[model samples]
Target: MPSSHLRAAFVLLLLLLSGCEQEAQAPLDQQLYIWQRQWRPAHAEALADSRADFSTLRVLAAQAHPGAGWSRIQVDRELLAADGRPLVAVVRLDGQLPDLDLQRTRADILALVDHWRVQGIVMQGLEIDHDCASARLLGYRDFLRDLRRALPADLRLSITALPAWLDSPVLADLLRQVDASVLQVHAVSAPENGLFDPARAQAWAKRWNDASDRPFLLALPAYGIALVNGRVESESPLAIAGPRRELQADPQQLAELLANLRRDRPEHLTGVIWFRLPLPGDRRAWRLSTLQAVARGEPLHADIRPDIQQSGPLHEFALANLGNLDGPLPERIELPARSCDAADALAGYRLERAADRLVFTRLNEGRLAAGQQRALGWARCEHLDQGGSRVYP
Candidate 1:
């Protein structure tokens, strides 16, 4: 038998080897898409994941603003051809309808659509949103009619219905012209912030299901919301600085939410599409681990805080900034075991304040965003403030 010291050294070596193997086996969070400008790196890494199944992977090429025209757009012909066929492209017609001359925009959009069609790509849908007014509705309807005439029979058309538009009597008639419709239940407009009500989202989805024969895709916000010094704005490279606090739901919570949504209304549900894939080197508020977990059929856990006054079936949570602004500031925070609830578990990070410097613990070191909300999977903070160190559970 080996001596005690020798046995101990052998055990240590074995543990170290095991750790190295785990590090090697850990999945690289490299999923990418061009929607958020993270196509190349993700493609490179995904090609390396031999265990990953890409059969169900659907590529979407979305054009959010057609009024700006398609001149500035760079279409990647190589990426567009996965196995030598065109990918599904969703063209978004956003902004005030008045700013859009439907006839001209339609012509522009149709030109691009035809170009892609000839390349053998599937133009899955034309996503549009308009205010609920008699003239606007009629004008939009007319545009759809012309667009439909222009599209090949196999091409699909879809529209986004604001909550108010869904309430309108014309919704049923309007949906008849399209193949699919997406209900943008969550409101992101200024003055009305973080208005994501899961119950309300479900209700709106149900209404669409009962009213229209068209299939629908429910758009959910993959990132959480935070008030950057009490200001809520759209996230972009040039927009307002990063979020003041991160408020993302955990992956398990997201899984539960999806599972619940599937259980409550499976017929209306098609599939979940995370808003804009995370950009390469983006350390902001996105849970890549959670996304991977969901994709791989793993259980996800979330830290949710409940709203007492809400009577809806869905649960809600909020993440807030805990440190003071005037002083040196608490550079880290540790959330104790009972800090979260069943619905809104702490799944991500909130960039609550804009600081010149910020540091993260082992799990979050390379993942935390300096000026944005970041969703957490298995990470925490250390050496916060001038006080004690805090660890996020």
Candidate 2:
């Protein structure tokens, strides 16, 4: 697309966005995506708080295709805090709209809602996250209208909307059917393209904020998709390999995006919600501190610490980085080795006879970012026991 066309489209979006900052701002919250058949809380200290409005729970995905089965998300009662925060039950619809049995899907959702309602859980809202194709916008709109009418009047009805829906003729009709909608502007990307396009996201937020008097929330990704650069198959340094790991969200990026959103947010903007809440050890997740930094729009620096433990006949160590910035996995570290330390005491460290310090040179090239930690090399320990402390100067 030409720059001029992009600019023109942006201007058009500005014209499309409705009402000035209106009343009734919604509280910001994080999503809890439970793909696990069962779940347990890993970090209660970080997760249990008023900061979260509601934990959007995925009740299940209704597979309305010819011979499909239900994929449910069941959580253990002990896993969550009953601190009065509601659960926004979300029913995801799978398969193509053309192939889907909308009636069956609607019936499945109602069953789920009633199931929850009878349980007496504190649930004030029910949302659907469906990426219905653009051509199926009308069908999606119709399905929502039916679903809204069928649902109890008290429960808030919302849908996770795709950017494609914004330009569709059915956008207004779709809005009229639901109590609210969330514009998910963050899409997976090539590293160069990034997980989010702030300009594009801001434009869409404005567009939706203006298009609907109904409540609107601009959803941003609090996670990252790691796209590794360079490949063995392609010699080019810039060649990106398809191999990827789910990169945890960077606190810096989140802070930056929140800052930008504040500037571009329209009058009708309710609040922002993260893609999902992250649990400890989740490969594709943000550190709890990272999420906190994002919520606060602040930069956090990294602090590195080393812990040593006795392993078999040798000593083992772990390096931890707790700061926000990636740094200080220093180029050279000196371990105060005891004279009783074996000659081969620290295998990876270069020993200085006169200095008596275990010198870590090559390992210093390592960079440890905040909220991450890893194993550090260890070696023979003579008379010393495990959990021994050595000072680093």
Candidate 3:
């Protein structure tokens, strides 16, 4: 083809691509926000501070369900303190509603709402994260819809959602009926168990944002690493074991993650909720410095530190052997650390044979503040014929 004709065709193709991109983007009028679980105790305090700059907040309620805790609602009258100020109240809906009276439950939630209103309190919203197959999902949706219809028109509603459900054909229908003040997309996938992928998380967010006009919030993990027999096991909260490693996330990686969210689906990008508040004994997770950066919507550019700490000879040897485990052991060993900072502040230590396996415990005095230290424990394992050891607790 002639040069002029080829150039004209290229220009036309570029224009067509640009038009398609514009059409695919969601409208800018949509609002964005975050839904924090009650697990983060400082949630209300955090919101009260400058960190609460987001457009909305979704509070998880407490409750018990059938079979196991599917998701139930608990109403607290003290949601607003006696002085008439907002107090962070959470109602858990983990298990199925007990065989209790339905009327009582409804009345309870209404009473809690009334109490909050009288104190001039503004609720964030509600959060529920059960499997889609559970009857709890349907019941919860109906309950929310009914509650929304009955409550003041200004009140907001929100819920926790898994990626799998976001992709379901029924999700659009289900969401349409609920009074969704915000939809929090939780990335609690068991990736090692082949249940979730991080990419799927991004896709799920885009899918929901594409399907509905409701605002969306993304929940990021705030736990530490779990090592066994020399291999990094999993990042799931349930699988975590051993002393928490101080893994500082690189600012750059975080920036990339946030950038991907913005590029793939900007409209749904309401805000982010760091999975947890500050906890003690979690050395191998993102630090407050990193979280503050995320809260600011600034670009992240730091590297994630490995979970194991290397201070002295014994500790270094113990860490090396722990990372090279071959099989499971009989008894689980516990190496206790006083606090998160205490674990980080260690200068050096060494590991030696403790019966069948080796053990190295850091002896430090410094400790994290009261609300910081959750707990810590470690296990010991025996080596296999191939000269490798394994430990699981």
Best by lDDT: 2
Better of 1 and 3 by TM-score: 1
Candidate 3 off by > 4 Å: 1-61, 65-90, 95-104, 118-120, 124-137, 179-187, 194-197, 225-253, 266-269, 279-285, 297-393
Query: Cα deviation in Å at residue 115, candidate 1?
Result: 2.2
For residue 92, what is the lDDT in candidate 3?
A: 46
Candidate ranking (lDDT, best to worst): 2, 1, 3
Q: Please give the TM-score that candidate 3 achieves against the real structure.
A: 0.51
Task: Give the candidate order by descending TM-score.
Answer: 2, 1, 3
Worst 10 residues of 2 by lDDT: 229-238
**Residue 42 displacement (Å), model 1:** 3.9
lDDT, residue 62, model 3: 44
Each prediction's TM-score versus the true structure? 0.59, 0.73, 0.51
Candidate with the greatest TM-score versus the true structure: 2
How far residue 62's Cα lies from its native spot in candidate 1, in Å, is: 6.4
Q: Compute the lDDT of residue 124 as modeled in candidate 3.
A: 48
Q: How many clashes does the backbone of model 3 have?
A: 48
Model 3 scores worst on lDDT over the 10 consecutive residues at: 320-329
